[model samples]
Target: MDEWLDQLANTLATTTLREIHSVLKRAIRQAQARDMVLRNVAALVTSPTGTDGRPSKALTRQQAEAVLKAAEVSELHAYVVISLTTGVRTEEARALRWDHVVAWIPSLKTWHPVTEVGFKHRKFAIHVWRADREGGDTKTRKSRRTLELPKLAAQALRQHHTRQAVLKLKAGEAWQDHQLVFCTSVGTPLNASNVRRAFRKITKRAGLGTAWSPRELRHSFVSIMSDQGVPIETIADLVGHAGTSVTEAVYRHQLRPVITKGAHTMNTIFGDSHHG
Candidate 1:
């Protein structure tokens, strides 16, 4: 079985091999539960590493700036901005809903959703609670975090809100109204292909070519934050990474970084031209 698994790993892509391995492991576990197997042998087998996949690439500060510039004219502009600035995974950004967006009212001394109170303040945030996962939750429950928005991201979302209104009017009775931050003309959720195809166009317009995807936007966020002298621990927390001490302690506060230092850093970095 080990030899056969190694041969399968060599024959398939790394992701494909991992998916097959997971399926087999779960199937064997199920069989054990049904008393059809004496032992879950699949769990005992170590899956061999397949060929290395594409090396992860992160955009430089200039490249990131260029992508934002190019994205300004596209419908996916807000999506690009949110992913790149907030370090959110593409799936999390896709699953973002209007209600999850909130603003801190200094006068009211509370955080109320933008959908409830409107984007009328300097402090805006996103509750990163959902993803395109099977149960519509983040990869791990602890990964759910609330991240403050830089002024640029807030402006982009505001503009996106207006754009979605336009789309709703055009669709009329056909609009589905899921209230997703990014969606189709009829208001349905966006699929991976839709996001990739649109993001590639933005990257190409930025002179980066078609190789870039929305996930790269997240990579760029990490790259930019790290390059600007932000602490590694803070970056890890902002990106919702697990197994870190920062994340471990953060849950006590629901992982809400007061003032969202990362967002402030981002605001200072891209805050020059995009602020206006």
Candidate 2:
């Protein structure tokens, strides 16, 4: 089985190999349950690493700024803004509704409806409790979280809400009132493919030549926060990970070690001026 996997590895990507391995293991488990096999041999077989898959990439601060600027004028501006700034998964953002958006009214000292709150007197936030998956629940229980919106994200969302209202008036009875924050002009839900295509157009307009996807915006958020010295635990919570392990494993490349603090502390204590 290992030899067969090795042969297939030459023509497949690592992710594909892992999928095949998973299927085989399931089959073996079923066979064992049926008494057709004494044991699950597939579990003992290790999956061989296959051809390199497409490498994940995140935008630099300059590129992120450019992308945000370009997206601000695009039809998908709200989608881009919310995903990048809030670090919400693309599916979760697509599943978002107006009701899930809330505003913390400082004057009232409580959370209130975004529509009713005065923009200057409140802070906007998004509750990520659903997704575009089967059953509409989030990827994990821990993924259900509330994220505060940055000023830029809030501004984009406000403009988007106004634009959507206009679209609703134009559609009149033709509008499907899903109340989705990011949706078609007629208020229909957006699928992954539609978002991906739109995202590429936005990146192209921003002068990015490399292939990019909507999900990369979330990656950019993680990388930027990590580079700025945010702790892994905090990042995990922001990204809705069940634990730091998942965040570290999935975004290992984006994470920077926090070892600089110790060195800086030592340098300050000893008055060392030599650069490493």
Candidate 3:
């Protein structure tokens, strides 16, 4: 096992190595429980550090804008818009259903005519309740959140819905409605490869390199919000992070150092009262 791992070390990444080790150990443990093996030899094996993998990157504001503009005319426009604007994970977006898309109706202090209430006056929102994981739950319990859509995201989704309806009519009997917001032409669920290929095409049209992925839209969302000085706690909640620690760790590059807020507040209060 060590020899085989050593041979793969040059090509595999550290995280991949750890995952392989974990799977092997679990299999061995299960076999032992069934009395198939006298001892779990895989448990004795430790995960070795492997080659470094590609580093994650977040897009700049200009790049994000370019991508959004390029994707505007593409079939995946709404998918890209929601991912970038809401900081939703790609898996969650893929599993999203039209039923989960809601419009927030604000309460009026005084009675208003029913005719005055319309979709135009409502704020669009999405409930992140499911993903491509087992049991159809989000990555974590905290990941199930409701996010108010920005203008661009709302517009994109509205347009996409109209387009999908047209396609549904065109398909006729072939249209299988799983209610997915994003899906194949026949209304089947889209695989990761399908999304990756479409994303790469969109990036290429936007004059971006081939290295970009759908996941980076979420990263761009984090970076842009952080750059705009949104609070870490708020960003965490928006991105469906269990805590600020995960948000900070995963998006360390996107986060601006917050150390100066205290100094600035102190300066405002003290105003250089003491001499040097």
Question: Highest lDDT, which number?
Answer: 2
- lDDT, candidate 3, 58-124, per-residue tens: 8899999899999987899999999999999998899888877876655743322212432364477
lDDT of 2 by residue, 150-201 (tens): 9888888888888898999999999999879888878999978988988998
Misplaced by over 4 Å in model 3 are 106-121, 130-143, 264-276
lDDT of 1: 0.82
Candidate lDDT values, in order: 0.82, 0.85, 0.84
Greater-TM-score candidate between 2 and 3? 3
Q: Estimate the lDDT of model 2.
A: 0.85
Model 2: residues >4 Å from true position, as ranges? 1-13, 16-51, 115-121, 130-143, 273-276
Q: Candidate 3 has which clashing residue pairs, if any? A: none
Please provide the root mean square deviation of candidate 2 (C-alpha atoms, Å).
4.4
For model 2, what is the error of residue 117's alpha carbon versus the real structure, in angstroms, after optimal superposition?
4.8
Off by over 4 Å in 1: 1-12, 36-49, 130-142, 245-276
TM-score per prediction, in order, is 0.78, 0.79, 0.84
Candidate number with the higher lDDT (1 or 2): 2
